[model samples]
Target: MHLDKTPATRGLPRERPVLLAYLRWILLVTLVAVASACALSWALHHPSFESEIRVLVEPAEPRVGAAVAPDMETERQVAISGVVTAAAAQQVGVSATYLQEHASVTVPAASTVLVIQFDDTSAASAQRYAQAIADAYVDYRKGQAATLSAASMPTAATTPNYPVNGAAGLALGLIVGVGSALLRDRSDDRLRGPRDFVERTELPILATVPVRRRRWRRASLLPVLRDPSSTAGEAYRQVSGKVERAARQRRKLTTVTLFTSPSASDGVAHVAANTAIALAQSGHRVVLVECDVRVPRLAGLFDIPSGPGVARALVGRVPLNQALQASEVENLSLLPAGSPGPLGPGELFTFGAVGRLLSAIPADIDHVVVLTPPVLDAAETAVVAEHAHLLVLVAVIGATTRRDLEGAAAELSGGPSSLFGGVLLKAGRGGRAARRSQPLPAEWDDDMGPTAPEDDGVAEETPGTTAIDRRGRA
Candidate 1:
């Protein structure tokens, strides 16, 4: 997965896996903060009030005749008074006011309304006491009234109201929830969408290859190739479309080279081959050229015999026609770097045959794709890049570093403008691309003739005379 650090023709945004993981963490923290704030507020703002109950009494004195004084009012020693103490208060039909002793009461001097409050275990008991205070004033007033020829009567008992504190709890919870969500979204850094690409680099993205999930193996080829509806197939097709678009723009037989930065992997080869197949499938004659002279890949990918390939072809030791073999896929062909050979001077750079081979391809063929070496080893890739009409760099999502991209960019940057298109590969999860519904293109009968059986794996060769693989893997 090691990729060239240079800014790709289409620099991709940061990985999404990192972003999603961050989002989850943010939400969890937010919820926790909200719950804690609510719990704390409820504990502090819990309501407390006093209430009481009491029997009310209305006492009025019967007024003696107004003239009782003239009639020599009999000196009667009839006196009545009531003492209400903590113990005798309730017995005398009065609610105990012990709780009120610890309570506070406030009232404006100019107002008759009073506010009596106390903390008590029982709301009913507090209400009873509140009632008693109201009753006592009523009784005393009634006696005075009667003596003055005007009497008042006691009123029915009423209980005080209780306060609620639920609203405060809700408010605290909301504040914590929203605040946390916002902070989380801002601090996150992993790239999530295409927008990140614009912000990070100057390269124009040629294609954004969706990440495919299906297990990639040699055996999975047909299933993937046949299932255009599948994510992997679709991605291949899209990549192919990109190739075709780039190819059409070029007026002559074009060499579309695929190279990844740093180490080599099958990713580039897969892209190169698939893209070639896709173009051929679309009815344009295509050739998948194995230009990696270091460690050729065409033999393995096409199941052809491996030997001196582009290197041999360059030296004129192997003829162009002898190096190429028809593919099982129609309108598609393979030019594998023929049987393995030793690296030598003038093998790639000094060859006039290289130019001749380019001239040798029939005009009927639409495109010639070269899978080049890693940019770090620019000798070979640069050679191929020089020859290619358009250069396409395939970079893995995370495996490529900024430094690597920069290096690759420096190597391939000055080439023909617009001839280069960067392909960002493996950017998403597997399932998102795997469940596509389109049927795989039907395998051609004559074109998809028997493919070469698998054999020794030397790896994809480099573009020039260098002895390294395209990925620098060797």
Candidate 2:
């Protein structure tokens, strides 16, 4: 009946379940990224073994006066120079360019020492090349005193540490996975909840009926008569009351309200049927019309014995009164969407029907609720909108999308129909007990038509109310 704040101020989604809808996707992405990165690192990386050999160095001749300190930095550079590398390559029977590419030199601080290091894929080759380079460097400095002191053979390569590499891969995977999830969340078109739907469409909320469970296909979800004490049932009652109030606010008498959705399976038909029942339960004379000729559900909804309905009446095969069947609910007449003739369902609704049908309905009827197909899916839905005084869009959370809502809003707003705001199919555990306690009609499957329970034609009504006849007359 009321609306939250405007869309301009809304950012984060309000519901916890809706916000976490795509959590599995994020976890999957992270897992796959981690596995792939680890696999690639293991496959593409090659280990490099390094070996080191140290040597002592001194001036070749004794100093005449004070002993000048040797320039170890300069000595370090000379050890790996072209001349020493060429000699080392000859000693190791390898090319000088190859030896130079794999060789490096360093010196200890404040000492006459040089350390020669070489790297290779083979550990033995690294050790041999390192020793050869030190021997050659000692030979190259003929005037200096140099002697090979010690050599350390490599046990393993330092380049490919599996633990470190795995940790890095994990960090990268987390970053990419979380970033992808965040970006997708911002651009996701699926409706999160009432606030998200309201934000995108900028339409007032008529009512929010709780959905205990999600269904792959449209199942039996009508709750007004199924369990009037339950949360879902009360919500439907709220929907009906708000709708009539909306019609009165527009100052319209005998208002014809159309219930629709942006896409199919949003439970628009179910909502419309329940709303009509709820209205009639509150003592309003109501006529429920199944205008969605393409996929008519109302004919089987109340187990109307497969008789003629609106489709046959529209094409003149039967009179509109014959198409109208009285439901079990008091004061409620149901006009089912009967099978179409040669004209086809699409052309039937889009071209013409509602104007003639309205003329046939009795003037005493206070509310006429027309259930129509989705706006985006069927062209006739917009055409049907042209005949109604109020339009109610049913939006199912986590199923109806933002783009579809915006599109539906554009289509309905452009028409002559008065916007009656939107109804949100809220998700919660409050209705779980109701759904379990109320038996779902086995007949209700993909068709979404649930039959009334078997009962004798008897009344347990108040003394003032009269019995409902087949023609919806007392």
Most TM-score-accurate candidate: 2
All-Cα superposition RMSD per candidate: 12.7, 8.6
RMSD of 2: 8.6
For candidate 1, lDDT tens digit of each residue in 1-474?
Answer: 112223543443343443353455555555565555555555654434454222222222347544211111110000011322233345335444553353344443433333334344445544554444444433544432111111122232222211122344345445554565556546533223333333343455555555434454453353235565665566667766766765555433443445444335425666677777777888888878766555555666666666445555666665667767887889888877654344442355343444455655666667777776676764666655655555666655444444555566666766542335456554334534221112121221122222332322223222433211221111
lDDT at 100, model 2: 86
Per-prediction TM-score to the true structure, in the order listed: 0.51, 0.70
Tell how far residue 268 is off in model 2, in angstroms: 2.0
For all candidates in order, the CA lDDT equals: 0.49, 0.71
